[model samples]
Target: MTAATSISPIPVAPVGLTARARRFVEVDSVRVPRRGLGQHRRKWIEHGAPAVEIDRAAVFQDRWGGLALPPAPFYEGGPRILGAGCPEGSTDEGWSFRAGSCRVSMAYGFRIGSDGAFGIDAYRWTPLHASTDGWVESLALAAHAGRWAKTVTRIKGKAVESLDLVGFEPVPEVQGVTDTWWRGKDSLIALYRGEAVGLDAPRCLEAHVYGGLDEWGLHGG
Candidate 1:
């Protein structure tokens, strides 16, 4: 008897995405406490705040696993839920923020220092942009980094001193570039040697390529 033959299904490609769609992005955020943790939580609860439950495993991976990229649409609109390392009943339970969509999935960790001060380390990502508008749209999507930082500050009743946007390009060693980092209209200040400098002054916003793939290995190193 002849051996049985098997057939393989043909592969299909995704529809509707253009060539300019962004396949990778990363942003790191930091915030400082402006008030005590208890006071902040009380204020948040008083305002009918939405609570974000901490996903312990997610937190561990984020703190130790580098960047964890979320699926499409990137930012999901809702209360900010961060991962934390604390006992169930501890006052230091994970934090939650008011719900809203910035078009990226955000994951972070909150810590209260020995001195009773608090801080946040956050990571945000999106797998694709799908925009036909070109680079400006990509930059605009990235500009949400500031807004995300500000939202966290508002929830924690803290001040956002600095938030940096670090672009992660899928391509190796090419270096991702953006026209402007800030989303909204704002002043750009230049300083040199403790004095104000012109826009023509040298300024560098660098991008470094870190070699690694997501858990799914969709992006090759």
Candidate 2:
């Protein structure tokens, strides 16, 4: 009798059983609207005649942009990145100013055209950078403010002793967490993780406690 050979196939699992978890800490993308400086600046002026500045060397606007001012960080000696935060989302320019101590994560999407605008998003951990020191919580909030995450734009003081509060905002949709050092201007400005929905809302946003930043080895400074 001839020897018989046998072959076995590998087992397969069902697709539904192996689907990804849809509700376990989802990070939505940030949004950037098409509005320009002339449109959004009005809000800042209404709040207070917040100073605005536009960079000439930036890629987005040659000389036609304004600051997306928020509030100043409670502490001094913050971290700042040049050419970030612009009004019209573009691949050209952006600016960010972060003082105090904070940890921030940012994400943005883009599209190109004559009248095109992109989406921008950011997430922050209050007292994010503990080693940075001073108002570590507040600093993290300041750094991740909507004003800083949208576009690469910059603002500077005309004089040496002026207080400049650079700001950023999310595009009305994405959401996450936000804690309260306080809320809005005149508030303590703590990290508030949450989501953005419709230019003035936080749809599915949430926040965790802000404490023991030192345990993360980020608050010793």
Q: What are the Cα lDDT values of the candidates?
A: 0.24, 0.25
Clash numbers, per candidate = 5, 57
Residue 104 of model 2, lDDT score:
40
Superposed model 2: Cα runs more than 4 Å off:
1-194, 197-203, 212-221
Best by lDDT: 2
Please report how far candidate 1 places residue 98 from its true position, in Å.
16
Error of 1 at 45 (Å): 19
lDDT of 2 at 60: 38
Write one digit per residue (lDDT tens) for candidate 1, span 89-183: 22443342221122344453333222222222233111111121222133223333322322212200111123232331233121112121221
Candidate 1 global CA lDDT score: 0.24
TM-scores of the candidates are 0.16, 0.20
Q: Find the 10 residues in a row with the least total lDDT in model 2.
A: 18-27
